[model samples]
Target chain A: MTDTADLEALRREVRSFLAAEAPTGWRDASRTQDDFVRTQRDWFGKLVRAGYAIPHWPAEYPGGGRSLAEQKVIYEELAGADCPRLLLSFVSTYHAFATLHECGNAEQKARYLPKILEGETWCQGFSEPGAGSDLAAIKTRAELKGDVYVINGQKVWSTMAQFADKCLLLARTSSDGVKQAGITYLLMDMKAPGVTVRPIHQIQGDEEFAEIFLDNVEIPVSERVGEEGKGWAVAQATLASERGLTLMELSYRMRGALGRVAKLIREHGHEEDRGVLRDFGTLVTQVDAVCAIADQFLDNRINGIERMGDASIVKNAYSRALRAYSALGLRLGGMDEQYVAPITFGDLNTGNWMADFMNSYAWTIAGGSEEVQRNIIAERMLDMPREPKGWVL
Target chain B: MGAVIELNELTDAAQKAFPADKLSPSRDESWQLAAEMGWLMVRLPEEDGGLGFTREASTALHLEMGRVLAAMPLIPAQLGLQAVIASEDFAERADWLERLAGGEYAPLPMLSAKLTQGSDGSISGTISGVFEADMAVAVVAQLPGGYALVPLDAPGVSLVERPIWDPSRRLFDVVLESYTPTLMLTDASGAKALHDRLSGEAQLALAADCIGAAGAALDMTIEYMKVRRQFDRPIALFQALKHRAADMKTRIVVAEALLWKRVRDESASVTELAAAKVLAAEAFRFVTEEMVQLHGGIGLTDEHPCHLFLKRALLNLQLCGNADLWNERVGREALA
Candidate 1:
């Protein structure tokens, strides 16, 4: 357990640092995708230099070896400061870092870890068009030709892949036995020959995600994360890396953005409307509960008491609150929201109610979907019987 | 860590006292057991000659009691005791405390009291939502003069059994026709303070109860889904129903998290506590609605205990202020 005094001191330290260095009006300045990427890189670099970026890493890395409580403090302050999320380096800091540090050999860690600190961004290549929620069913193929393996596949829904320098690629090594058994994890250079990156134009007009096409992209076998047919296990490490912290951060950010809703109510003269106030009040409590649950989830993780479906509960709560938050804003905004407005890049509550509402779908549809989370909660947490797979009536 | 351990111990003891196999166990027996366990004084300070346990301990007890649908009026009993404990002006505070700890029931009304003060200083109207009033020695109520301890046997005061849908406990109205106030707990300002404190406590207790019952309801529904076969297989094999069950579990877990967090936070406002209650009640509502539907026709019959949970959820929503009142207050406060 973490000492209260120690956590409070760390919180004060982070708050003072943020007061001096946190970016202001970054959302307004990030009018273009390139601008958003630039702002994100600058913030990530500052955090890395300040020793506040990779608190979950080992003591060997700067700003590392912090307790989960300390990490939570840092995230809370960052969210409170409304700092631009370290979006561009999200994969590099979490997914790639976890995969390399946990599953990669010493040589691979030495090669990639330092560059990540130097602002080399990474994106995941796990989800393909054919996979989505059933990630193990990915069809991307890799074949060995001497020391290099030829990779050919297309990956979608890879966040910020267009700006990434490296890719955490998963591909089929063989078609033997189970679909997951034949898979292998490899690191690919996004700028390598026969690789193409295309940004996805989302419904909210934010190109926050991108697609990657790999055609005969050859990579040395040394780039493999683990033994052949062990990528599924390694991918779990990557997926689990961002679980507690990101949601905690986002929940706090959403709580802070309640002011945006409040402002809308005031502007629309609905502050005196009991119906609108009730809706807003309901949303406020929902968001607060999400924050509370997210905090509890991390506390449980810190205490080694986390259960199978705890993360799913936090994710679902956060996403549902987010949807409710935006839907209320859209309703309160009325006719003005229906008219198109410039959307803030990478911000969930941008005051563009229509875009914000549309952007809320990203949470429900992505990251294993709401339905999949429900399955995990029902079967894993509540001990409900899992439906037999491949049941045909 | 000590607090969490205390909570677990209390929860285990409660489960042992009121097992799930016996739904709505004999109220008088459970109430006596609770008194013997010193649960009534769980939150009263040690200086006050009580257990001096933290809020988490009481919350744990409430949750376990809710799980089994225990028939004891523990929530109102505790709240009523807290009212006496919080009062400095009441001369018989210690005597009242001793009697309460000795298993003499005196519950505060869970709903608002519709009363008016006459020019002659007498009070009239009904104090609704008195749980198990037939067993109560007195009712802690808010009057025009302030908060007063009104003995049920006093002149012009009587208990009217209201006959509620929830069979897990009894509800009654304490009708006061020109009832003279006795045992003044607090004056106007002091009464306001105690009212705020008890309302906060009431929210936490109700929230814990909802969370506990919601968990049991989800478990019962899931258990039924696993065994009740349809279409030549257990209904749990259906993804649609399984997903709904998952949602119920999620809502319950999240609300429980909030409830536990708020219970430990001493500085939480009344509105914040009410918000926790609203979340719990809503989750309970969601779970019980699914509970009945998932159980199919058997859920609608009196043979099953599903309706008990559903009825309790609906009643809990109407207690300590309904979802509408608290939600509007929450919104109003957040605006500022």
Candidate 2:
């Protein structure tokens, strides 16, 4: 509930900070996965020192405790300045921080929270090959062996796990109850014995996510986030940690990237083509609407008026718009896009239309697939009756 | 905060006046009720002898009207009143405001006028898209000279009802055969500014209407899905149908967010405003289309309210420049 004047002041402060310290040409600098990670790390470090990186953190921590409004301002400035998004440290500062801050023991919190600011990156180990949108169906197994939790599982779709120092692992400790009830959340070290990190080569030729295999990886019992078999609730916090801001930032970036489509229009001599203009116009409006919805979602959260399935709507809208944006670019880019231009890693709207179109699938498929989001909207928000459970094929 | 509270109060009052159950309530009664409620003057400044509420107030009122699929022509009437209020140079501005506030209907045309300025300084053409002109004392038209009040009873002026698919309201073509402009609101030099202002307002108002009606349409579809059953269970339980409904809701919410954002932003360009309207109207069309499909066979009947919503959504898309026109303009602007 920041007042307009204070919000404007914060915006100005962020704008000035971005002007001074924001990385330029980082997209071009991020040609390889390693280069992308480097650019991401450098920008995250700069933002951390300038007190704009982790505004959602508590006041006791530097660059923390900013309101949602303030966080929005920072993200908006970062996106507007075309700065590199803090992709490498995202899970550390958000998911890890949230899980530790909200549900961790004091020792765990003190151990991890400070390290996060010091550039210790983390990745999620919740999704499995068989789990995905049905995350609770994960078959990762963990058993208590004295003071240590012996873990054995294969976790896929863990973003940046290949480079992560720690993994927020969700494993099945008890299979006697519902799928979600048996799960346990543990902070496992990525460097533990028999822990294998294999980066998943994405369709766009980037390894933004990886698969982690644990063959007798031992995590101390103290690393558990909550009571055994109660990890589902704790996982909710980690999932909900970063909301509104990311989508808002992405949507704004897409809106700004409309210039790419304009350039295509000009390059192809489609300026007088009514059909192309109409399609571009439709895409522009869709992107604008996505931005609006993202902004409104944040405003609702700030005002505490957010309702069930609000986040789902924002996600679906943003993903659909992202698809439309890239598709339009791909269409206009035509034979040129098919010739394989080098893609800028870790960015959705990199002006490389083919790669962008392929990367857009990440948004729709990851972070709760579009279909899953629709179910949430219908079953929860619209009060539609759910299907009978325990149906066998 | 005050504006928000007032908007809420206005919405509540409107819903109470035109309950959702009654679709296409008698147009005459609704118009009278709206005028008596001071809705026609919602945007008139206090100094102009009318309610000095902001555009949000009228937008709120329009949304409420849209929810019930009200038959009244409030959108154009409000635009007309705004046009008169903006003409501070017009000698009879005060008189026109008083007359309009007192329920003398003067509506701004939603479509362009095809006119040829006569050699004798008279204009002859047909101004189309004047909603409910049969009830209007005059139509506020943009002649070649400028924006002027074309009195319905004046010589060479005639109204021809142009039957539209949307039965909730009437549309007419205001034909002028060598008609002289007596009530000039703005000269040719000032017309573009006034046109831009009115167009922006029209976009917001229409956007609000689309959002409101789209919400209602979605609610109706959901209600039908829940009650209507198939395959030994309620269809609402089916993922296929439920997902469609969810997409419908998403479109409505997203377009609505854009509408309110543009409505609150004073510096939004005309193209930006049109972009908002285009999104909202498209959403409305999408929702209504889904509404009919989701409702099944009953939706095809003339007696059902689904057709009403569908027709209105379709018409709203065409109003204030169709999606193609606005989208091209939006594309051009973004390119520039």
Candidate 3:
């Protein structure tokens, strides 16, 4: 754990770095998907060169070896400075890096970990057309052929897959035993022959996620992570890579963006409206509580006192608060918000209330759906009995 | 970390003193026990011949008391004791602190006082929300002139017990009839400072109480759900019921996290502290509401303890300003 003095010093150092290099007008620059990708890449490269990115990586890698506390400091500074979040490179630096560091062979790690720092982006191909919340029931087929695996599957909701250079592909290698038993995790080149990536047009007019179609896409056996049919365990490592930090950062960002609500209240001349004030006040407290819970969750993890379903609680609270924040803004923005406006590419609280309200759904629906998280909280944390599985319809 | 360990030790001692099974224990007995435990001076400085524990220590103690729905007036007693401690200018400050720390009760009222100062330096009106004033030697109140300790035995000073819905504690109105103030704590100008300080403390203490009580309420509900069977199975196995329990748990944990966060922050505003309390009290209300419904017909009965939690939650919501009052203030502050 970093001491208080050292943490303050690090905060100062980060503040200085951010003051010098934080991107301004990036939101305006990121009106289009390609421009958004360019802005994200530029900011990420700057962070990497300054040794601020990948703080969770091991000490062998540059800009790595930071404790969770230090990582928290960095993220707080990043979010506080209003810098564009590294949205495009998120899966590459977190999910890919985690899978390689934890489960990949030495050759795979050596080949991929360094490339991630050098701007090789990755996307997850875990959820299939049929498998969304029940991810293990994927029907994607991967058959072993000589020294290569021919993959044929359709992956939906893969975040920014169209822009990724590689894919963390999960496909079924066997139909034997349980549904989870046959899944295999492979690192496949996104540009491989027969691989197709089509961006999903979101309701908010942003293509933040994509649908990847794999038709006999060949991946060498060397690219497999862990043993065949044991990908679920390795997938756990990838899923658990970044805990608490993202939500905590987003919560703080939302807290900072409360000014947008205040601005709306002022601009709409609701300053003297007690009903509006009360609503704003309630929303403010909700957002503040979310920030508090997120911070506490990270602190617990840092202190090794995190319990099961704690992350789920944080996620649910944050998503709910995000909904409340955007809904309030949308209500106040009225007909103005309904007007079609150019959406901000990679932000949740952009004052574009309609887009933000639509974007808030991603939090409740992705990572784990709200219902799935509720189950985790109930069955795991609360010790409630789980429903009997495998019941026929 | 040391403070955390100290808080745990305090919590353990509180649990040992007041077990979870004993709901609404005898107020007189609990008050005596709390006094003997030196809890009244948990926040008093060491130089003042009291235990020099931080606000966290008191918060922890209050949480334990809340868990069993203890009927003791610890919150008001602690606030009154703090009022004495804050009065460095009072001539009898040390004597009052010794008396308060030594088991003599002088409770700060939970509600406001409606008083008018007579031309002859006397005050008359009613000080409301003084919990267990029948047992108090005096009541610390905000007089029109300033803050003072009005002795219960003083002529024209009387106690009128106001029965409240929350049976866990007693409430009273300390009615005054042109009673002359003898023990002055603060003058008019200094009153706001002390009020802000004590209000912040009261909010945190109430928040801790809400969190602990909400936790117990949730636990009790879950226990009942585990035993109450429906559709040939325990209701806990039902996903719909389980989801509600999960949501209840989420509200409690999230509110509690905010409570502890604000409690640890030395610079938190009174409004911020109130926000924490508001979230926590609402969480308690939510949990108890679910607790009753989840328990079905049994929860609605007077014999069951579910209503006890519900009553306490409702009362706590109105204490130190209700949600609407605080929420509006919070919004106004943020707007400013």
Candidate 4:
């Protein structure tokens, strides 16, 4: 209650700032991945200079130390303004910041944290080809030869690795214990020798994510976060870094993008078609409900009353609504959406219904996939019985 | 924030009053208890000699009542009271409000009516979806003569019981044959405005009820899954069933969030509130259907409560403008 006035003031400030400075026609400008990255950096830099970026950072750092409610207001404003999401620097500002700030030593923090603000982007190198939803099953091996750990293995699905200057590398340092226990977390310079970054051509024809090959790439032991073989615990911090904020933002964006569906309905002259209207209406409410749940999820977190499966519920709800949103667009677009159109980078619901539909799958399949979130919801939240773990496939 | 504490207190009181184990406890006795607890006056203005509470308070009560499959017609009763309270032009508004608040039954029909007003201003035809009309002193039927409080004891006013699939509550058709209008709650000019106001409130209440019932249905299904075994293990151990249950939870939680958000939003249009209802009703329908299927053949039996929830959900969908009506309106509104 005490922060109500402060939050209003912050909201007002953000709104006025966004009204004047929020980029227009960024989607059109961001047709190519390079243009998208440039747009993202410009927006991120503007936010940083305006003291709106990295609100979750420490008080000593610029644009840091915002409360969860304040951070929520910022995200809400950004989404409401239709500003480009900070996809290129998401890992650097959140995942990397959370990891170093929580688990890194003072020197690491002083060295890397400042650089993130200086446009040094980082990508997660944790998900290997063998890992993904089963993240602990990573096969990337790291050997400590002397002062540096020689990392050798492949990491797939690393978002924006091609543009990243550093990587949150998770590699197996031991094999004698549980799969999760053998892992170690390190910060590796992307320009380091024996490191290769190749963009992955997605089904939607966007190279937002890339595959990283580490052929004995060396990361100084000083760059290692936490103790060796304890990276899984640190990785949890990284994975949990963004919390429910991204989904909340995305939900708002989706809600705002409902206009696209409305536009399609009119374009196709289905305004009088009760069936199409009903479907559009259903999707509208679905998106609205997702926004509500996302807001509730963050409110619960801010109130310190969030349950174990709350985030999973928010994630699953958001992904399903995203699927429904894009599906409705694709359905309403009909024949026109079937044709290939140039897709916008780093934006969902870009009015290109087919590409947007394919992009929706990324949400369902990535970030601990829909199936995994469902398991968490069922087993943890609902208290349903877990399947016997020892059964082999 | 204060409302949350009130909600918790209300929830605790509701659990104590109507335990989940006693499903659909004697409707007459439960109605009496609800009246005694001042639920009828929960939404009444404090200046009107009733507890001044926000819509959230009433929403909380409806939700809790819904969880137990309450047989009491609290929703209609509250809506009826709200209608009287909002009718400033009515002559006996205060007296009618007092009686309604003190548990005299005068419920606004949940569904629409088809009445023809003759040249002499007399009304005929029927108002359907009147819940628990057997105990009502009157029914709030919207006549072209204006929104009037038609007393059941008046001439040509009769109640015909219309049995429904949902046994948790009873329904009736308030039949009118040359029924003369009296106790005008609102004039012809005010009728449309009051109807819109109460319709929005009705949608919120039903949405809350649907969400509550869906939650209860999902809880029941999950509990049964944990205990019921097949193939030498609890059926909940299977991934397929667990995923379905999880999806049910997700739908309920999301819909509930929308319900609460809409309840607090005073600027929300009737279409928006109805949209909330559509979402909640659909979620409830989904959960109850899953409940019946997940419980297997036992769910089909009359003795099982799964069918009760499913029936209530189906009926709730119609009580609202139905998903089809509300959804189209919502789409139309969004387009504008």
Candidate 5:
């Protein structure tokens, strides 16, 4: 109850700020991912200048470097305002900047950190055809041919690869060694010759992902982040980010969705449907529990101890509740505008329901499928026997 | 406060204390070993020299049992012990209780049987999914008026033993015709009360099982997403999948919370109990089905153990009622 009150005040402040700064037509205007990215980067660029976006960025790296609690307040406000994301934050804040601060050599930091801080984006190119879930099976070959390593192989589902200015590339440098042992981590130029980019069409009809085909994409060996054949270790270092990322703001997201549902109920003239009422009750309770867990886990993660399983729990639950809530939105609205996106349902006020339901799949699969998370919980936490047929032979 | 005891720690200790090889399949030895540990009759009242824990503790015990996926009828026997604790005549059977608790005697709760009509006082027919029937010394049945404690060796009764998804809790197709019964209460309320309490408790137990199964399924899906790439990035980081995986986590957590809360607060209504059963059932169906789809090609086969989870969920899903049916009930209640 106390936290709810604090949350209310935070939400109000965010609502006013967003009302002033957010462009009016952005809500109904459907933009391509590229356009969306530019708008978001502009927003992030302002938030950074205004000292709101990088609240947790270690203060030195384009981040306000605020305390964890202060950072949580920012997320709470952001969600309260239903803020659009920069998506580039993943590259700038989590991956590249984190690498620069943690493991980067001095020159590497001097070269890349400022660019990232200034909003230059990088994409992770860890996954190869042979190395999807079995990331160690990557067959993307790079030879140390003099000062430059000749690169060859293809990368698919490279998030934002087409738009990225730089790429965090993983390649095998040795023909004879353990598959995971022969790898190298490099920050490579995206516009280098022999590099090609093709967008991958998702079932959701979003060209947000790309396939980067490499043929002799050359990078000097100096671009390597760590010692050769130790890319696997550097990649592992980046993974702690999985736990570091927070959904703390979902408490506010839940509130916003509830507000939309509440408005839909009043205006839709279907307030009498017992099914819809039950759906409302279920969603409310679900969001309540989800927000509670997220809050607890946020507090835990902020305290410098992480509950990885709980992180998985948060990612899985809220994503689902939101999807289910959207289904109820469609149900309550009588199926008239389910396919309509880029247009906010004015009377019903269910903005972006269709986009969200289509987009929610990323929650489970992105965080590691619920199954992979269970293996971690079972093996690492509960101490159950190793999952039969795990990553290892 | 409600009398539900949370003994996950105790049961975890029990599992470690009574590990599996000691209770391996085909050894009545596991039951004997469990009896020595007083686990067989942990739900029986202390007046009968049993542990006297309420039915809620059975959930904690079953959760631990599920961790190993052990092959035994431990949960049902404990349910039978609770039945004994609730009845005066049944409680007086100290030899049965001590033996039941001590593992010398095995009691079975034969609650689910296809209903049949009878002209007279006695009704007889075949009922299925009566687990451990072959191993049970005495089978207990909750009738319309009271419970019947029938010795397995009694005349006019036949049990066709069969395997179910959880082979540890084997199934039985039992046939009985106008069989004379023992230990009948003249009043019916006791029987209904026992039925309600145990069914609620049983559904909760089954829900806990689904949580275990769903937890496993989610873990598998996560692992597959992390390494299994479609284009270049781990398919997991993709938005479409990341959300579904997150959703599965939410469902399981809700089921876990409600089940635990019900156990912690045993005063929940039958409708509340039914709602939980319905939600837990649906959670499994949804989460497990998604698990298979997320795993892609390898998940669709018998080799994946994903199907095993589906099968378990399907059986339990049907038992307490299907989702649409229960959802309708919840709607009615919310309207009221």
Candidate 6:
């Protein structure tokens, strides 16, 4: 029976902190904006010093004591302020740290949790070239040798492997049943022998993803979270956190997109045109609908009665909203803005618009494609008879 | 989520409650079963010889009728009766509904649907498209000249069956040169109120029927895909086909949501009901069309239920109002 007034005060305190900490000169900063890494690291450090980072973890764990409500406020503040935490804080704020909060053993928490909170470093080694959506299909084998297991596998799309000091690796421990039963979740040192990271050029001209090859990488068996062949279950737990935490970022993008469109239309001088008005009206309706659903999703989570399947609805709705907003931006730009070559800022703003448009394709594909989401929704929520599993994994 | 409308009888009793033999496959026996059940008087009060139902209850009944593709003229009949009762003009017709519910005064007991009170103390509207016009015992003709309860058998009155797409429904075109009067009222608010009340009723009927049809249409498509083989496998196994079926399910789900919203939302009214009709009709047409396309050539035939659904789609599309118009008006209603 927490008091509403108390929650409001905590929320206000977070928001007030956000207003103070919002980096100067950060307004719609593009993906390739210079000084991003340095700026992000600096921002992450300041928040850590302020004891505001790792807000979801309890205070006793060398983390800020905050309820889910307070944790959401922090996410909202960071997103609303347009603070860059995606690649920078994902491992600390989302992956490894999230795993520690959820499934970490007592000793594991005391060790890996502290490094993540101060943003010292961590990286995910979940996806392999052989395993993407079919995560359990990963063939990264970790064999027990003495007190340690030697790991050998390739991981792709390791977002920040260039700077990450450690890799939260998932490796196969047995080849029984399906690929899932033979895996284990482990915290591995990135600097270990036979681990190599190579950046991949993205469509957006940034190396946001990488290909990591592991050749007999050796790590203590103690790094494993649970039994050797239980990786798939732990991986599922970690992946669940990805969906639960990132929704606020989607909302922020949607709001900013909505705002930009309003500004774009007004600038384009079609504010009063019938077609444009209708489009605006429709967009407004959709935005309201999305916001309502998002609010409801949050309420359900807070009430401790939420459906995991509904996360798909939010992902689908949010991506589509972002796409809708981006499409509208392109339309407003017309031939001059759309069907033209990109230029630097002030030359043509579609570069930013185009960047966002390109970025949204990954929203669906990144955290399990919308098609996979449909399967989850159908099987779990609607209780549809399972389609014979189509994938080899 | 339809308003907790505890009806006196069944909810889907609109047309389905009528024995299938009497109301469907051309409704030749409506005179015996439909009229006998007091389907027309479902919305009327017991004081007025109806079963004493709420507006939501009555609307729900008609909706259920549409869902089953029932061919009873409940909307027009009960609407006309409501007017008669409200105007205190039911002195002679008072026993009509009692007999209706008792399975008497049926076979072809029709009161009127087409008479508009006229000016110059004369009623003159042609009242075309009168449902069950030929079967009417009399035409409730209202005009500027006067209000007349003229028997359909009267020489001056004409009831020509207007070839309707819904073979089950008998829409009539009435031509009256100058009909004799039954009773005229200087004020017609009673009739107007009934008209107003019936608009909501028609909306609910169209929406609910569309909901039922949409469900049926999706079922048909899913079943068709399950066995229809292409590329050496059932088409339903194809991801492309599966996604289309999934989209249809989404629309039906939305339509169902809107149907409940129309009946339950505090804002539920004429406009909300109309929106439901539009959503359901569009969904019905979309699903039915996909059903046919999936069936290849067989779906376009008269033998298939697809055409019937298509007919209802086209009919419902134009009925109440078109979807775009309704969607636009919903926003306007909010603004107002």
Write out fnat for all predictions, comma-separated.
0.86, 0.86, 0.68, 0.73, 0.09, 0.00
Candidate 2 per-residue lDDT, tens place, B219-323, comes to: 999999888988888889889999999999999999888888888899999889989988889999999998999899999999899999999999999988999
Among residues 3 or more apart in sequence or in different chains, the pairs in candidate 1 whose N, CA or C atoms overlap within 3 Å are: none
Can you write out model 4's per-residue Cα lDDT over A1-393, one digit (the tens) per residue? 328899999999999999999999999999998898889999889989999989999889988988899999999999999998988989999999999999999999999999999899999998877788889898989999989999899999999999999999999999986788899999999999999999999999899899999998988899999999999999999988987899999999999999999988898899899899888888888889998999999999898899988898888888888889889889888898888898999988898988998999999998989999999999999998887765687
- The clash number for model 5 is 52
Each model's number of backbone clashes? 0, 1, 0, 0, 52, 24
lDDT of 3 by residue, A98-191 (tens): 9999999999999999999999999999998789999999998999999999998899999999999999999999999999899899999999
Model 3 C-alpha lDDT per residue in residues B205-293, reported as the tens digit of each score = 99999999999999888888898888899999998899999999999999998888899899999999999999999999999998999
Each candidate: what lDDT?
Answer: 0.90, 0.92, 0.93, 0.91, 0.66, 0.64
**Candidate 5 local distance difference test against the native:** 0.66
Write the number of the candidate with greater lDDT, choosing between 1 and 2.
2
Model 6, range A67-118, lDDT digits (tens) per residue?
7766666677676765655566777676787677777788988887777766
TM-score of chain B of each: 0.98, 0.99, 0.99, 0.98, 0.83, 0.78
DockQ, candidate 5, vs. native dimer: 0.07
Regions of candidate 2 where Cα sits further than 4 Å from its true position? none
What RMSD, rounded to one decimal, does every model reach? 1.3, 1.2, 0.9, 1.2, 10.4, 7.6
Error of 3 at B287 (Å): 0.8
- Over A5-63, each residue of candidate 2 has an lDDT whose tens digit, in order, gives 99999999998887788787888899998889888888888888999889999999998
Q: Is the docking of candidate 3 incorrect, acceptable, medium or high quality?
A: high
Error of 2 at A256 (Å): 1.3
lDDT (10s digit) by residue, model 5, range A344-378: 21111235656555555655555466556655544
Pick the winner on lDDT between candidates 2 and 4: 2
Q: List, residue by residue over B67-159, the lDDT tens digit for candidate 4.
A: 888888999999999989998878898898889888899999999999998888899999999999999999987898788888899999998
Put the candidates in DockQ order, highest first.
2, 1, 3, 4, 6, 5
